[model samples]
Target chain A: DAGITQSPRHKVTETGTPVTLRCHQTENHRYMYWYRQDPGHGLRLIHYSYGVKDTDKGEVSDGYSVSRSKTEDFLLTLESATSSQTSVYFCAITQLLAGGRNEQFFGPGTRLTVL
Target chain B: DQQVKQNSPSLSVQEGRISILNCDYTNSMFDYFLWYKKYPAEGPTFLISISSIKDKNEDGRFTVFLNKSAKHLSLHIVPSQPGDSAVYFCAARIFGASGTYKYIFGTGTRLKVLA
Candidate 1:
């Protein structure tokens, strides 16, 4: 386990409502990522943070924004929730193994339903 | 365009059989590949991974095989068990802008191991 946790295990909200999801990591790893899982698209990257206050957009970052104020916390916000935005969001941290190869450890995930 | 693709959406295998899941990628620059197994309503867990320099990496019953020329990789689970049933995803690590490496994931293939 990478000591990753996501808030709001399940939620239901109306369209246009704003929502925020939090990811907390106890490992203090330098790299953190947010991804969404959809039935046909699989897991699509939404955003990532290389360090505190350093963030980058992922392929599917159109309606989402992210922030990292501390090494242990990363937050993802949906400015206006849409039906298309409903998904299971995952948080992950990268870990380097002895062979110099890296792998990501994921959180429990948050299921959001936009009505 | 999707750089990583898992053409098969589902597969079924008899218990104590071998289960193979395939993934294809378009980019040759991907330096690392990983496989993740996810159960319903839970986060994905790392199954196994292979570096670009190696053709195969095995961990117990899970083995990952990479073909650099074909940009293809596959996960082989030997002596499949009922507990091995889950949605499997393949991800490739690519160097993105700002010296950050991003993971591109396939749509996933659901494996159902029958008893």
Candidate 2:
């Protein structure tokens, strides 16, 4: 929904290798976010961008970094893949509506496996 | 530790019955709460939301009830259908020290609606 799409929907990388996931949106929404989903952990935010080049870290940003050099693109990079980082990654966009309330729309997702 | 919590890991319901999912939060300052539904191999989709100022919000067969005092929230789906089976996530939005809004999410609750 929200015209969001994620690249390389499935990937497998070895330990110590680097991997980057791409998130693309066509709606031009102002907020973009990266999150990882694991069993019993729900969805944990890794990073979010309010505008181009205005990215900030989330609670689970320890092993991940993000960049948003354009309005439609947000990327997440794992410096070195680890087994603990093996999870399904999701990209989301928050539509800030009137009255300062907002709702988030998400992309299909990317499944990453680190061995 | 997670700020948002969904204690129940899974639930099973009969078709045409009401399915109730519960969520709790440790942070009382969250002003906005939302519920999202996710199917296998897909990202989550926004379902409904309730503001801290309001205790209840409804949209057709789905209703969200909030108790600010107890820091609890629940989602109700009437006449549950087989397609209604999915993982539900509760998200809480709170303003951060940097003046930006941050969302905290619960682990998730999987609901199985039997035909």
User: What is the RMSD of candidate 2?
Assistant: 1.0
Residues B3-72, candidate 2, lDDT per residue (tens digit)? 9999999999999999999999998889999999999988899999988989999999999999988989
Clashing pairs in 2: none
Positional deviation of residue B14's Cα in model 2 after best superposition, in angstroms: 1.1
Candidate number of the best DockQ: 1
| Model 2 regions more than 4 Å off | none
Residue B84, model 2: lDDT of 96
> Where does candidate 1 clash, by residue pair?
none
For residues A1-115, could you state the per-residue lDDT of candidate 2 as single tens digits?
A: 9999999899999999999999999999888999999998899999998899988889899989899999999999999999999999999999988876789999999999999
Report lDDT (CA) for all predictions: 0.95, 0.93
Cα lDDT, model 2, residue B75: 99
At residue A48, give the lDDT of candidate 1: 94
Q: Which regions of candidate 1 deviate over 4 angstroms?
A: none
